[model samples]
Each structure stands twice: as C-alpha cells, then as structure tokens.
Target: MEYEILGLPAWYYIAMVAKVLVVFVWVLLTVAYATYAERKIIGHMQVRLGPMRTGWHGLLQPIADGLKLFFKEEIIPAEASTFAFLVAPLIALVPAFISFAVIPFGTTITVMGCKIPLQIAAYADKSGGVIDVNVGVLYILALSSLGVYGIVLAGWSSNSKYSLLGGLRASAQMISYELAAGLALITVFMVSGTLSLQQIVADQAGFGWYAWRNPFLFGAFIIFFICSLAEINRTPFDLPEAETELVSGFCTEYSSMKYAMFFMAEYANMITVCAITVTLFLGGWHGPFTDAFPLLSPLYFIAKVYSLIFLCMWIRATYPRYRYDQLMGLGWKFFLPITLVLIVGNGLWISVIGAGNWLGSLFA
Candidate 1:
C-alpha cells in the first residue's frame, strides 16, 4: 500500500531530516543551559553565588565555559595512543545525542494544513518522535551501553594508571546498575505491552501515568532512578572519577575541546535519562489543556524534565559520595533482588488483572 500523511504521499524521510535538525538544536541549547542551572542551583544550596561575573546571575556561563574550552590547549599524554584517545570523546558523545531522537517531545501540530508531529520521527501509524522503530526501548538500551566504550577506551589509550583504574571502576559500576535498570524497564514493557516509546507515552496519557497508576511501577521508578544515577556515574555513585583518588578518572589525560566533549556528553545523558523517565513514568507530554494548546505539550515535557534535573542536583548537594563497596552492594545485594521480585510480582499482577491483553489491544 502507498502510505499517506495528511492526504499526501508520505515523505517521511524528508520530514525526518527537518525534525532532526530542530530537535538537535533544541537538545544542544538545553544541555548548555542545564549546566548553568546546575551550578546556580548548587551555589544557592551552599549559600554562595555562582557565575555572577560572567553575566547577570551567570546567564552566560555556559557560553563562556564553551569558549574557554574551545581556546584551551589540546594536550595528548606522551604515552597515550593518539588515535583511540582522539576518538574516545566522540564515541562517548554521539550516543547520548542520538538517543534523544527516539524520545517523544510533544504531540502533533497542523502546519500550513499539513499535520506534523512535534517529535522528529513518528511511527507509520503517525505516533510522534524520530525513527519510530518498533524496538525503541532496546535501541536506547543498546546505545546507552555503547557509551561505556568511550570511557573504557579513554582509560586504556591514555596509558595512565589512574585513568585505567577509574575506567575499570566505571565499567564494573555500569554493568552492575545497568542490569537493574534494564530489569526495571522490563516491568514497564510488561505493563505497557509495547516497546515503542511513543506508544508507551500514549498508554500513560491523562490519568494513566504508570508512576502512580500501578504500585509496582512506583517501585520500578525508584529502582530505575537509582540505577540510572549509577549508570550515569553521578554523585553518590561517581566512584570512577573520585577526585581525591582517581585524579579525574578516565579523562585524566584529556584536555581542551576533547575534555569538553566528555563534559557535554555527561549533561546530554542526564537530559536523556530525565526525558525517558518522564516518558515512561510520567505522562510524556500530556498535561492540562494540552489538547486545546498543542504547543503546551513540549512545554509540559520540558517542565517535567527540568524538575527532575533539579531533583538530581538537590541529591548531589545533599548527599555524600558512596564508598566503593557500598555502591556495589546497593546495586547487587539490594537493588537487584528488589527489581527481580518486582518484575515477578508485576507480571503476576498484570496477568491476574488481564491487563496484558487489555493493554495490547488498547495500544494495538
């Protein structure tokens, strides 16, 4: 069958390009400002001013930081492998940025009488987001896993003992937490009965947000959040880069824009995680009057994501870093068992309630 969109032959590839550019620019801007916000927030928490000298309330801090990094001296360790060392940052950075493509930012809008989705890619059935692949969840999982390669390569290529140790720690930490994170998502898959993120979001529209709708899902959310923090090597779980110990971890030998790439990648991953959390547990882009005002959909999504980002910063400011052993134990001894039990319990609950079939048909 010849596919059609808005009564015309579907030129989805063309539309896809346009959407990608818009989302790319939007994500870049968001990453830049997220850094600024984090510093400002942390400063206030500690009762100190942040970036006041750069612009009013440090409004220009991210730009200034970018410029400084751009102009900084590029340093390659004397013992480092030049090729791998140079490529490591790009490997770390690309996945984080591309993952956002599959994330649904908003609903559809009619532009010049052509119905266009706010998301860059949409499914054949017109669900929003980029590259509406049936296995979007798996795609995200695979891409996220790929980011570790950069860290590992950075450590090995740098020929620094400190970087090597930090990289090893990161690899171990990511593996431990990623299992729990993946398991937590399995519960979501079982409940929603689809791997398509846009479809998952659609299932949670209005009052059906899984975070509160299913008690088990709330537990999954907690597990996912904790595991995500560990996976991203954030505060309390940032063992790989323990400043006092690893001397800046896997990136110890990185300098200039190479260092900046890794930095940007971290923030990008943060935004990606927040976006995914909002899509799966929260209502994606659903909000009050969203049906009437389609533009409000992206706004709602951004608001939810930023709120979660603030929570991340709050935790960063409030908590101390976890001891290496404690971090491992929490992932394996604690979170693993909890998530395994929740998965079984959730599966049984869905079966008992016949939600499995119901959800399948509802979204199908």
Candidate 2:
C-alpha cells in the first residue's frame, strides 16, 4: 500500500487529503459569498438595499441561510427511490470539485524547501499525462457534462412529474449549451495551439489573454459566457427550476440536505465554469511580466476570476428569465452556428498565420 501523491513519499498522502479539505472548505465559503454577492449586486441593480442586517452589509447572510436550511424539516417522498435520491447530490458535487484538482492555479514555487505547483495530485511525470492532461479542456467538458446525470437521476428517482420534467429540461438545456461551449473552447485551442489548460495559460503569459487576441475571441467569449450560464443553470436560463412553472423543478420534492446539495452543486458548477473561463480564455495564473515578478501572477488570476464571477452575479441580478424556447433557440440557432463558423474561421486564420507562431513571436 505505497500510494504516492505527485511522486512524493507516501506520507504526503495526509498533506494531499488536507489540501483537498482546504479546497473543499474554500469552495463552501466561496459559494456562500457568491450568494451574498449576487444579492448585493442585484439589490443595487433594482434600486434597493441588499442584506445589511446579519453582519456588516449582510456578510453573515450565508450563515443565516445555512441555519435556515438545516432547521427546515426533512421530507422524503414515500414513492421515491430513497437510496438513489439520497445519492444524487453527492454524485453531482464531488466531480465538480475533483475536476479542479487538475487545473493549475499558479506557477511552481519553492515552499519550505519543497517545490510545489499550485495544483493538486498529478500523475508521475505529469508532462502530457493524465494528471497534467493535455486534454484538460476536454476533460473539464466531460466531467461537467456528467453532472447532468445526477440531476436526471434525482428527478427520475423522485417519481414526480414536475421533477421529471425539470430533469428533462435540464438535460436538454445542458446538452445544447455544452455543444456551443465545446465549440467555443475548440476555437481557443485552435488559436492557442494547445488543449492543455496549463499550456493555454502559459501561451497567454506574455501576450494579453485570448480574449484580447481579436474580435473573434470576443465573440467566442460571449458565446462561452452565455453557455456557461445555461450549463450552470443560473437565472435567465434557469427554466428547470422556474418557480412559477415547475414549482422548484427537479428538486421540488427534495428537502433538507437534498435540496442543499442541489444548491451547493449549482454554486460549485458556477465556480467550475468561472475557473474554466479563466483558465481557457482569460489566462489561468498568468500576468504581465510574471516571469520577472512571479508573485503577482496568482493575484491577477484571482482578480480576473472573481471579476468574471461578479459579472455573472450582475447578469443574474439584472436580467429577467428567458422563455424556454428562447433559451434553446439562442443555443441552437444562434450560438452554435456562430461558434462553428468562428472555430472554422479561427482555424483558417491560424493556418494562414502559421498556427500561433507568428502571434506568439509578435507578442513576445
């Protein structure tokens, strides 16, 4: 039983576990504040004050929310597949968190005489391997896409019509948007000449982000952002749980912790998409002159990611819900075609310009 983490001694297993624990805690805390940030931003958008009572402009609102959900009566439907119902949320959430393990957060640094890459466990000789997978973008897409299963299962296992319909809607919504998202990501890979997220970030090291690469990338960014909203089931694209129509959608019959699991999964997915956007398009932990002053890189990366998250919250607060058909039409008729053409155009443009070599040199 000699399990090692990143080729380190087996004793580092405890440190790996501790590392994951810390990330879990961070995700929980981030989700809590994301709710708060959404409220405050939306409140201001609607010309009203946001949560200000709990703790200094409502910092403790998430805590209040946790207490509320905790004390709420637990309800399990008599006809539900009780075991599957209970398992769905965990299935949905764990993968969302685990995918982050492969995403490199920052450059390697010497900490306490140990070299550390701001990433979690990677396979030994991580270069171009599963741990530091060259197909990171695809891996993220695959993992995030799998999240739909948990929702679908929860809805089916609930044995309720509303829940079932909600699940179906979610399945369709995620599937459609994932197509556009995949195409958009392909455009990034085309322009950057790599599928590895770390390499993508590395590519953006000197030159500005892919978002600044050109107007085409801006279009891709728009498509990616919109698709992410649908993928994460956020407002405007939140037809699955449209309170007026579906009565809380798939989790209508879910209660207590089950409901909380769905809630947590939503936020976790949000973070995942945000992280993906940062890594793929905005440049993961790269910054100006980072090779000279490496410390600022991670800060810049965090700033960009949080800013993107803030923008998501802003959109949630400002926009009204879309009609279900409108959501689908946007994905199919509009984003899909545009992304397809853009990806093709990107490939053509890259070929003409010699596969990012010219761009890289010019930027360098």
Tell me the deviation in Å of residue 98 in model 1.
Answer: 0.2
lDDT per residue for candidate 1 within 88-175, as digits (tens), equals: 9999999999998778899877665456666665734434333466787898899999999999999899999999999999989998
lDDT by residue for model 2 (1-364), tens: 5566567656446545755786677778888888888888889888998999998889899999889998899988899998988888888887787778767677765444344455664432324232357777777888987899888988899999999999999999999999998888887877777777766776776656787676678789888988999988998899999999999898899887778888888988888888888887777888767677666766776787789888888888778899989999999999999998988777777667544434557746
lDDT of 2: 0.80
Give the TM-scores of the predictions, in the order they appear: 0.92, 0.90
lDDT: which candidate is best?
1
List runs of model 2 lying over 4 Å from the truth.
1-18, 123-131, 355-364
Per-model tally of clashing residue pairs: 2, 0
Clashing pairs in 2: none
The most accurate candidate by TM-score is: 1
The lowest-lDDT stretch of 10 consecutive residues in candidate 1 is: 123-132
What value of lDDT does candidate 1 attain over all alpha carbons?
0.86
